[model samples]
Target: MNVSPPPPVGRCLDMCPMRECKEREQQGRLFRFETLVGEGNWARGRCKMRSLPLADPSKTVKEYSRPAAGKKLSSPCDLRPPSVLLKTVNYLLMEVWDHVNERDLASLAEAYIFVFDRLRAVRQDLTVQRIQGRLGAFVLEGSLGFLLCAPYLVRDLPSDSYDEVLHAKQVRDCFADLMECYGMDPKCPREAEFQALLLLYDLGNMDTINRALKLPRGVGDSPQVQIALAVNRAYLEGNWVRLFRLVHQLDCLQACSFYRHLPNARDNALRVLTHAYSSRNCRFPLDLLVVLLAIDTTGMASEMCRRRGLAVISGEKQSVVFFKASFKDSGPECAGREYILIETKRGDFTWAEIMMGENEGEFMRPKTN
Candidate 1:
């Protein structure tokens, strides 16, 4: 006798013969993938199967739709221990970030992207796993240090580079996240430093400086905080000499964070100086400009002067001849060299040492002759 055809597969787990039936004798077959109802084709839903009797293949298949009670899913990253996550963050800061340089802009950008992604992953893990106490604080501090270095790395890159804006925005957003972390813990010793960095990051914004001033009594008194306030005040007053002087006092990371403001500050200073030293025959020593603008070399200072339509006379001492009428307002050009202050200070400590707060007092002290 002819047998009736088997029933068409339905949405229920038991209705689909393709699914492995748990009730059947162990065949060790793998479960087939299935798309659940209302979920698009791309959505995956796993199911435990039950077999029906061979005598009746047409019966409606039983549903095993609900997930097992009390079962939970977690990402592998979320499962990592606090120590492991902290180590990963430290690795990125100490090892991976050390080699990121400006030799190849494309490669530099790629390296930054890679390191930033890993750091972000670790940070997310710390948050999701609810890591707290000293370990969490250390990890957060390390991540903040990494964020603070972003501007220094990209400082020399041409502003028109395709990834420039993307890099800037990402760094700002990540910095804000780190600040929020410290904001939750008022007593963290590093919190004052990060708050000061926020002020330095936007020196032109009076609101940021004002908010910083209103912090708990002692925060405004911290060395970094005092320096950041001074820098902001000097910037508002067009006092480039005092501004760069205060910048020289900042620690390596804080100076790096403040580098972004250099171009605007320099531009504004040169504009004001144009009118102040207006005589066509009056000569301003390029060496003095170097000191005033915190420029690394007189050559770079001369080039910046030339760009702004000043006349440079070369001899025993290079000097710029300022004529208010000839001074071209060429907005702000990135003219300064890599911060020698950071380079010299960085040479004294390894990235690991910096992260550990080793010799912190010496590190933060203004370099003296």
Candidate 2:
């Protein structure tokens, strides 16, 4: 039996986009600055940056522009398949996969959109969900890769090359805008859609999630929406027990699409949990809280505890204690601690935040001081 290897890990996935940029550069002038927003247009005269290989360009363009005379799609929703459409889909996906593997960002983005549109058009009538699932995964992965890489691509482009930036920005906006729509469109995975976008938030450390820009205008009322918002709340507030629970508890985020990055999310929550418990006067029996931290082994907990300058006693039921060193008191004014690390201020909420809701009635109330 042949089994495929697992997909890349979180850090590897985070860096994959950047690696694609480097790989594209290494391909050495294959892609010209000349834009090809259309599939067949690449063969046209705009090859100023570099002339590309053209094995019968005219024939390729003509054949690409329209299906062969004998083989029209035959109907708006064609399902009369020896599963012939499956073959077409596979060919397109192969082109996409090849472009992606070659790190040809321009070609990959164009082919991704084309394949997605074709898949969606026929997905409704397909007899097998396997193709749909594969395409869905591809779309998710491609969109995520480009989203991570776009800002870097734009930054690397020369300041004088407005055209290249425009092209890169178009590819970035295509999916970001689609996601913006998906987050609001009632026909989607519903309230959980924004949650998936937040998974991108964790992966990319994007400000759009923190500032709440990624959320759609129609969200904010549902339990899942509230729960998703609360996940961020728990994270920001150092409530790791709750944050771990929320990130792993996908009942509210059933259709979240971000993948291979989830283990990173869990690790992050545990790290934060351990960090918090390692704070001053925060001791607790390891057995009592390890499950909430998603800790599976006593050995792992003990190692982490020792590394973080904590003591772990060996026993059938074990316990770990950490000590956070205290700084010297400054003066009489410093007799008691003053709250200075405020991440949010009371009465600082804006009505603009309500745009995340359908109407003001569905808006979350602002926290008061």
Candidate 3:
């Protein structure tokens, strides 16, 4: 009978990290190498073997399976969750993914846990630039998650980084452009609709202020302008109580309804708030007004107050009260040329504007926009 040549020692063993590889190594026969140096003692110098291709060291089989290995991971937005758990988790994950994808570090950092939990293995293919580009498109598509998270993500990026600079400008400029597009006019068909939105921007009482600044091109007497005036009036009047209350309501509503199925929720809110804080209102009240002013305007309470030459002292439990003995002029043309200069109150004060008298059973008549 013809004898077959012995099979090469197992070269594939080199790539195996299993216990069998160790056992083979201990026996000094770890790999499948085709050539046999000596005859097998039991076989009587007639080795039974088959020739097999040697293992390519450069292309060895890998054992460990990483989640992000090989294929690209799909976006959280890609899969729509069916169950509540899946929905919540996916929504939460989408929040993070959208933030990171939108290049919004500030927002991602705010809800960091939500983002960090969804990440599995690191992919070599995904880069920061790619993420930012995807985010830019997402923003253009009016993704509220991106809009909500954009501020935070952009905040987290390095101040000196080019992306940071561009994104920061983009958020403000985009908001301004959108406001201009809508044209803040109380006569807007949606004026009544945007009332709550005006409050969100602290512009609820803006019509009163427009009456004060009677420019030929009147402050667009819209709900948005009213929100701006409300913020300014709150700041001017040094009414922290009302300011915080309004902001808390606005923030709560925005946070809750940001992506709710409710129709026009996000757009309405964004429209109102954007117009309110983007104006050249009195610097004093703007400083003390927190919430959107802090989120949308210049900065935090103390810095805004300081910049306006107002005294900001941290009161009990981190409450900030701004007080300054500076006089400012405010009055409508109906009040004649004798503009009233109200004296600044030093103490933490709260005063309500009295309900003005109405004409012919119109005490609470909702003024038509």
Candidate 4:
């Protein structure tokens, strides 16, 4: 009788993605065997131990006796293979991966449309639910990366680049379709899509973000949408103090079920602000609320109050804490534009004080007694 010894186990290379293979190797090695023609229990459960390798125990051999078990079998499980188009899409994704890995933004921007087209093909094939389910994950990941890079890419283009463009509608339509996929699978383990939209809001691409925000979801109003709106308002109003102030407030915003209601509101707000900041949209609107939502500033909140000459007055429900912000000039620009921050006590409200100053170095004078 001849038997083959078990295979020698070897350490796996680092960063290998073959999880199942690694798991299988955790058990003892697999082996094979050959039976003699005059086997004692050929048709029976009886078995016999074959002759072990007679060579030196420590010596490696060119050949060995056959063992009991046969060759290891292929894994029974495999991911559903993608269609030809999808396989091509995967290849393109690999290219994008390489381009990104190489830090070649120019090449990536050039090949981006090919990736987009392939994704569109996959979207059309979604008439088959399994294909949709399988491909949606890949599509979402790629879409998120693309959306995240959109602001950078768009800003990089020449100002007149879009003047004669006819493809904007097509691109927008594709983006909408991709967003619909993300919406249908809200809990699909793809939070990046939601994160990307938040970035888009700060990137000045409100048109796409607004459309995505309108989709029905488990929650009526996404905190991301609210934060985006706040930042947008700050930009529109040209209030730099308010915008930067919002950045400070966002830093203090805890993910209270009573407030943000989302699990990762802080990170989400940070992403939005970072994206908006990266867009170089320095024009800030002075809306305190918008500034509060855009940046994560905390210590300045109290200083903001003192600078406005606003007294806390009272903490009662009707006589809520109130503070007003106004400039010394009080010109037409400063007339109705100045803001009042107030908290109510028992439903009646009173002015606490007034605040002024866009520059942090200046002092806020309280109202004269």
lDDT (Cα, tens digit) per residue for candidate 1, span 88-114:
665565555554555788766655665
**Each prediction's number of clashing residue pairs:** 0, 0, 27, 46
- What does candidate 3's lDDT look like per residue over 8-91, in tens digits? 222222222234333433444422221122113322322235232223232221122234557422333222112222223233
Q: For candidate 2, lDDT tens digit of each residue in 264-304?
A: 44445545455566555555677765666545555655654
Q: Using TM-score, give the best candidate's number.
A: 1
RMSD of each: 16.0, 19.7, 23.8, 23.9
TM-scores for every predicted model: 0.69, 0.37, 0.26, 0.33
Over 4 Å off, model 1: 1-81, 99-109, 126-137, 154-162, 350-369
**Which candidate model has the greater TM-score, 3 or 4?**
4
- Candidate 2: where are CA atoms >4 Å away? 1-175, 180-195, 199-218, 251-283, 326-369
Measured with C-alpha atoms, the lDDT of residue 341 in candidate 4 is 19
**Deviation in Å, model 1, residue 36 alpha carbon:** 38
- How well does candidate 3 score on lDDT at residue 7? 24
Angstrom error of the Cα, residue 316, model 1: value is 3.2
Best-to-worst TM-score order:
1, 2, 4, 3
Off by over 4 Å in 4: 1-91, 100-110, 127-138, 147-171, 182-186, 191-223, 235-369
